[model samples]
Target: MTVKKGLKDAYSLKTPMDSVNLYRAWASTYDNDFAIKNDYRSPSEVVKYYSKYSKKTDTPILDVGAGTGLIGECLREQNSRKIDAIDISSEMLNLAKSKQVYSKFIEADLTKKLNIASSQYGAVLSSGTFTHGHVGPEVFDELVRILKPGGLFIVTIHTGVFHNQGFKQKLSQLGKCISPPVFHKVNAYGSKIDKKHGNDKVIITVFRKKMS
Candidate 1:
């Protein structure tokens, strides 16, 4: 496989297999080659809103699209609860496993019904998943389905996708099931060598499942 590792390759993904293959090869160097090199700040940004809005409870947390455990590492620092990870790439999950941040690492596609039970998580957090050529708002129903009543659902959606994609419409469709979403603009990367992507930004969407 021709392993072309760059933001363009990630942004150009058209299918789940594309993600699987790309990350499978890129997993080993993902942190350094892409994340650190670009001064990726999405994970920390997700954690910031999570810390501000979510209660530190024993109820398990699920990190969706948890590539390389970046979010998991941050969450581990804040809470020592049972945090589980779900991602499509086993290679990425393997790297995440080494961090020892997640109690469970699940390899599954978010485009399908996850093996997880409904209302099983107190909070579901994700970063860098809802972007161009990646999973879209289509998975929102399933993500929300896994959250316990009153549980928090926090994720970072690339600003462009949030507007251009169906995220706004999907959130409205889920309005009955969840509270009004709170969106926060966040820098997707800090000081970076990648000038083209240095200005990338995201909207950290935070909302809670309704307690009926």
Candidate 2:
């Protein structure tokens, strides 16, 4: 298939190499393409939820799957300045950097060991990263590892992913790693994209790591 076709068909790719290439191809247009087309608002939504329990404003927040800094934009709008972003795509990071949202940008894949020190961030957030063909709950191990005790974690996990990807089991195994986790039903993958999609569906989840 032509490269253009590959970019268009990115959602179907399940392999690691394809995931990297797909983001590489779509990075430049991502903010306008998927972000605008689907009315992507999960970034702002994630930040908004975390605001309910805003912690240290001076420490860094680790934005996983920060793709184009949609969440960073929201965080910045709220006057958050210590946010740092990490993504697998250098191209996407470049776009995010131009927005001047994140204090620092790290290029790292969620499926691999992130080159970040442990218990460093005061909070962690992500959106549109745990969907089909992307990173999964296994990344949470690293997330839990790096987050300081009492750090907040807000993530938007696709409902299908929550059930099918052993997230439940992982959460059970990870008990007390964080306070009792709660799932919130915030809109995701807009209806304009699929009228048949569950209008009642949502993917927002929020939690706070317990003091160790």
Candidate 3:
């Protein structure tokens, strides 16, 4: 929980409390130590795809597992839409708050129902949330529930668990509720510079809620 080991510590987290403890210790320096040092690319990549596929620009957006406001920061550079940040760690949320990039911040566990109403957001983008020991495909139901009809839901899922963790099957089962997922594969880190997790990849899954 007292994570000093960076990515390994993040990937080894098992319980929600484990995540809380890890981020609590890592939050202050997360931007420089974890994201910049590792050359993390998921946030930018996910946002890039969000801009590419999103049809609306004014509706509210929810940044899940927003962690230090990386996604919100990237989003702000592109638009002025109301973007809200949500994460499980208050410490991390505090760091995100300092960035002043989000309109609202919600601290909640993704494993349970968010206090938000259904079909509220025009688009929802999450980066570095669905991975080794963090969140899983089960949160997809709640995510979809909060998304408006025809809303875009874009997220990065660690490729290592895509098929084994039932994400593929779960997405398939959501047939009528969502459109078929469009997967964009990208390196989680700048492979050329970071040798440790250089080969690590995440599937940026893009889908929309059915208007019906």
- TM-scores, each model vs. reference: 0.96, 0.90, 0.96
lDDT of 2 by residue, 64-170 (tens): 98888999889877875588989888888999999987889888878888788899988889998887788888999999888888888888887767898888777
Among all windows of 10 consecutive residues in model 1, the one with the lowest summed lDDT is: 50-59
Every candidate's CA RMSD: 1.5, 2.5, 1.8
What is the C-alpha lDDT profile of model 1 across 80-122, one tens digit per residue? 7788999999999999999988899999999999898899999
Location of the lowest summed lDDT over 10 successive residues in candidate 3: 1-10
TM-score of candidate 2 versus the correct structure, residues matched by position? 0.90
Residue 176 accuracy (lDDT) in model 3: 84
* Model 1, total clashes: 0
Off-target runs (Cα >4 Å) in candidate 3 are 1-3, 192-194
Error of 3 at 40 (Å): 0.7
Clashing pairs in 1: none
- lDDT of residue 140 for candidate 2: 94
Task: State the lDDT of candidate 3 residue by residue for 85-191, as single tens digits.
Answer: 99999999999999898889999999998999999999999999999889999999998999999889999999988999999998998988999889999999984
Off by over 4 Å in 1: 1-4
